[model samples]
Target: MRADARKNREHLLAVAGAAIGEQGVDVSLRDIARRADVGLATLLRHFPTREALLDALLRTSFDGMAVRAAGLEASGEPGEALVSWLRDCVVWTTEYRGVTVLMAAAIEDPGSALHASCVTLRAAGARLLVRAQAAGVARGDIDGADLFALVAALAWLGDQPSLAPRADRLFGVVASAILTGAGGGDVEGAPPSGRG
Candidate 1:
């Protein structure tokens, strides 16, 4: 692709990602094209199908989280690293609200390009979860699957028609539950003990 064409493709992906994620998959391709100041043909060339576009958008977001997670490894304590990465994930999810729905749909149909990336994301998440458990910051009983579910739920929350004022509070609840110590006997939906 020409430099300009590449730029257009990236722009369309970014705009469509935010718009569809904030709105719904029902958002028109024409609208995305208009917002990107590109012709519909250009958009189609980059993202032949709506599913393809969504998958690309999701891949882009996951790639970002992966980079952030790697950086957090050396940032501070392991538990703190997990908290930082989770906050970053929440911000990404909120930016792309309907992403969880896309994820589910992709899972239901593995032929979709999004499925592989989703699986990769799951593996990456598991690594973070395990690291926290090893650090003794999180309860050992917290399963990796449950942590992934929490992330999907958070993405669903981000997809809301409007941003909830309690976005931070919700994140806090999630972080606290995952950050409890073994002796604390699992926070499990409880608020932070106000000690850490």
Candidate 2:
């Protein structure tokens, strides 16, 4: 692409990411075009579909998470690294209000433009999970699919306005449950002791 065309595409991507973060994935493409000061045709030329735009917008974050997971696995304790990455995954998935739901659906549909990115994201988490499990820190019964659902559930909880304040506590409880040995003490749903 020409320099000007590349500039226009980058501008559109920046504006679109902001718009989606604020207004959600359902935000209008026309509105994004307007906000970016680009024509609808230009937006279309750059991103042929809404899914394509979303894929572009989220690809970097997913890639970053994968790299972060690899680094954590290399440097940190297995259990701590998994918990830390799970927290990051919650933040990433809930950064945009409605993006969590879109990601959940996209991961299930191979035809979705975001499927490849979602798969990569899940694989990253799965790698950490395997390490933790191999270290006898995580439950052996659980697998990548369970971890994916756990992340989505935490993201959904974080998305709700009323529940947002408790998201961190809830995340901790879930993480504890996953890490606790089989037949260990029951996991409490409430916030851990000493935390508000």
Best lDDT among the predictions, by candidate number: 2
**Regions more than 4 Å wrong, model 2:** 181-196
RMSD of every prediction: 5.2, 4.1
Report the C-alpha lDDT of model 2 over 1-196, residue by residue, as the tens digit.
Answer: 8998888888999999889878878999999999998789989999999999999989999999999999998988888788888888887878766887888899999999999999998999999999989988888899887898898888888777788787777887788888856422443343221111
Give me candidate 2's TM-score against the actual structure: 0.90
- Candidate 1 C-alpha lDDT tens digits along 114-178: 88877766666667778888878876887656766777676565555354544556767767777
TM-score of each: 0.79, 0.90
Error of 1 at 91 (Å): 1.2
Give lDDT per model, in order: 0.69, 0.84
* Lowest summed lDDT window (length 10), candidate 2: 187-196
Clashing pairs in 2: none
Tell how far residue 44 is off in model 1, in angstroms.
1.7
